[model samples]
Target: MTVEEIHGVRVLTVPEAGPAIRGGADALDLVAASFEQQAEFVVVPVGRLDPEFFTLSNGLAGEFLQKLVNYRLRVAIVGDISAHVAASNALRDFVRESNRRGQNWFLATPAELSDRLAGEVEAGPEA
Candidate 1:
């Protein structure tokens, strides 16, 4: 596991798919699966996501986001998702909402993610 701080957010990079699957009990399993590496937050590169997750449905995507929120885990997905963004209004809305909440974010690049996170940290807790 690799850890770095962007603004006030601690970002951890782990092997692809490692955090997405884990075996255990139900809710505990979900939490454990989501944070096996013990990260305060994580940035999952777009390439790291499975092809099936490309479409934002009420199923997998929702479940994933729910787990992240449930665990109070902040995530920033970095990549070029122009096609995905263009395909669904709902997905666009979800992305917009996530960015606004400052919990989940979608950035074109790691540098952008770093800059935005730094700005948020400078903006202070009231933001």
Candidate 2:
């Protein structure tokens, strides 16, 4: 992982290729990894997550997101998840709501994440 500070948001960029993150424990490991790097936010490429991560029945997505929330750290799933979203309306709604809440986001590129961070900075304390 490589850590970069974008608009004062410390972002840990996970490698595009690695062991798939499959469950809550794996999600916790990611938080630990981010803490070790002293990063406040993690940017995980979608390819690194298990296929089941996008499937709500597996509960992996909720478990993982809850872990991040409990830790008070933000995360952005970075990459294309259109296929998964297309396959499940529930997943699409989840993504939409998550984005609306602003604690986490599903972004397609590093540029989008940078834009989010920048926007948050511009929004000031209320953000």
Best by TM-score: 2
Q: RMSD, each candidate, Å?
A: 3.7, 0.9
For candidate 1, write residues 39-126 as lDDT tens digits.
Answer: 6677767766655565666366666656777778777778898888898898899888888877778888899888887787788879
- Compared with the true structure, the alpha-carbon lDDT of candidate 2 equals 0.90
Error of 1 at 81 (Å): 0.7
lDDT by residue for model 2 (21-41), tens: 887898788899888998899
Return the clash pairs for model 1, or none: none
Q: List the residue pairs that clash in candidate 2.
A: none
Best-fitting candidate, scored by lDDT: 2
Per-residue error (Å), model 2, residue 75: 0.5
- Candidate 2, residue 40: the lDDT equals 91
